[model samples]
Target: MKTELVQCFVWGVPVYRQRFSLVASRPATERFYRLIRSAMAHAEQLRDPFTGDLECDETTFGGARKGKRGWGAAGKVIVFGIVKRNGVVKAQPIPAHDRASIMQVIQARSREGSLYYTDDWQAYATLKLRGDHVVIRKEKGRPVGRDHINGIEGFWSYAKNWLYPYRGVPRKHFHLYLGEICYRFNHRDRDIEPMLISLLKRLTVDDVDLN
Candidate 1:
C-alpha cells in the first residue's frame, strides 16, 4: 500500500481521487494526500538554507473571483518568499505583510553576511541589519546593470504557473501547497522523483499511519 500510494502521487498519471477513488473512499484518498504532504513538508524543511545572494519578495495568491487585485484584495493569500540567485527558494503564506511577519521568514531561512535584493517594501527594511540589503525600486522601470529582484519575481511566476492545475487550493491546505511549490522549485533542475519516493517510504513503512 505504501509503495502503491507513493507511485500514485509521483506519477500524477491519475490525480488525487482519480483511480484511487475507484478502490478507496474519498476520505481515504484525502487522508493519503495529507500524509504525503506531511512527508514532503518535513523533507523540504530539513534542507540547508541559503547563505548566498538572496532575493526577497511577496505576492498574493488565489484571487480568481471578481474583486480588487493584489494586496488587500478579497480571498487572497499573501505569500512571502526568498530565493537564492542560483536556485533554491523558500516560501509560505504569511499572516500579514507587516515587518513582524516577513522578518520571521527571513531570520529562519537566511544567514548573516549574505548579499541580497528586494523591492522597495518597508517590511524588508531591516534585512540590512543581518545582511547586505539591496533595494530595487519597481517604479523606476527596469533595473540597471545587475540590480534586480528578478529571482524572487521569477519564483512567483513559476509558483503561480505550477499551481494552475490545482484550480483552487483550500485555505486549510494552503501551507502544504506552498511548501510543495518551494520543494518543486528548489529541485527543479534535478529529478525529484527518487527524493520524493524516499521521503514517502521513510514516513511510512508498511502503510500510511494517518491516525
Candidate 2:
C-alpha cells in the first residue's frame, strides 16, 4: 500500500503536497482523493448505534451566517449532529430542523435509554420520553464538566474547519464531505493510517451515492 498517498490526503490537500504531486499527476491526485471521499463517504458506514451521554446539536453549512440563528437561517443548509462524549459523532443534512426531522436522526444513530444533553430547544423536548434529557440554559451560563453539549458543539467547529480548506462544496456533494468528517472524527483516537487504508480498500463504487 502507498502510505504516503493516504498520508497526503489525511494531512491536507494533495495539490500543495509537493512530494506526492511531483510523483503523481495533479489530475490523478485530485481524482484519487475524490474517489476516497466517495468510497468512505456514507453515514450508513456507522453500523452501531451510540449510547451513553450523547450530545445533540445543529449547525448550518454554506451561505452567509445571517438572519435567524439556526434552523431558519437564510440560504444555509441545516445539519443535525449527535456526539457521544468521548466517542463517535454522526451528522446528516436534514430538510427541516423540526422535531420530527431531528428525532429521526437521533433515533437511528443512537440507542434508546442514553442520556442526552442539549441547549434550550423545543425540538429536543421529544427526547424526554426516549430518555433522560438535560436542558442547559445559556442565560444561566455554562457550568463546568458534562453539564453542557460541548462534545457535539466541538464537532461542529472541527467539521467547519475541515470543510473551510475546500473553499466551497456544492450542495450535491456536501453529504459525502460531511460523511468524511464523521468518519475522521469517529476514528480520531486510533492509528488512522491502517484503518483508513483498510476502509479505502473495502469500499467500492457502490458505497458512494452520486444521485
Best by TM-score: 1
If scored against the real structure, what TM-score would every candidate get? 0.84, 0.84
Per-residue CA lDDT of model 1 for 20-93, tens digit only, reads: 34445656766776677667766677777679899988889984678776687888999998888887888888
**In candidate 1, how many clashes are counted?**
0
RMSD of each: 3.3, 3.1
Off by over 4 Å in 1: 1-5, 12-23, 139-141, 204-211
What overall lDDT goes with each candidate model? 0.76, 0.78
Model 2 clash tally? 0
- Expressed as tens digits, the lDDT of each residue in 1-211 for candidate 2 is 2576678778766355454344577766656666667765653455588898999998789857657766576778899988888878888899997889899989888888999998788888889888999987775466455488888889999999998877777687788788888888887777666776777778756675654
Instruction: Indicate the TM-score of model 1.
Output: 0.84
User: In each prediction, how many residue pairs overlap at the backbone (N, C-alpha, C within less than 3 A)?
Assistant: 0, 0
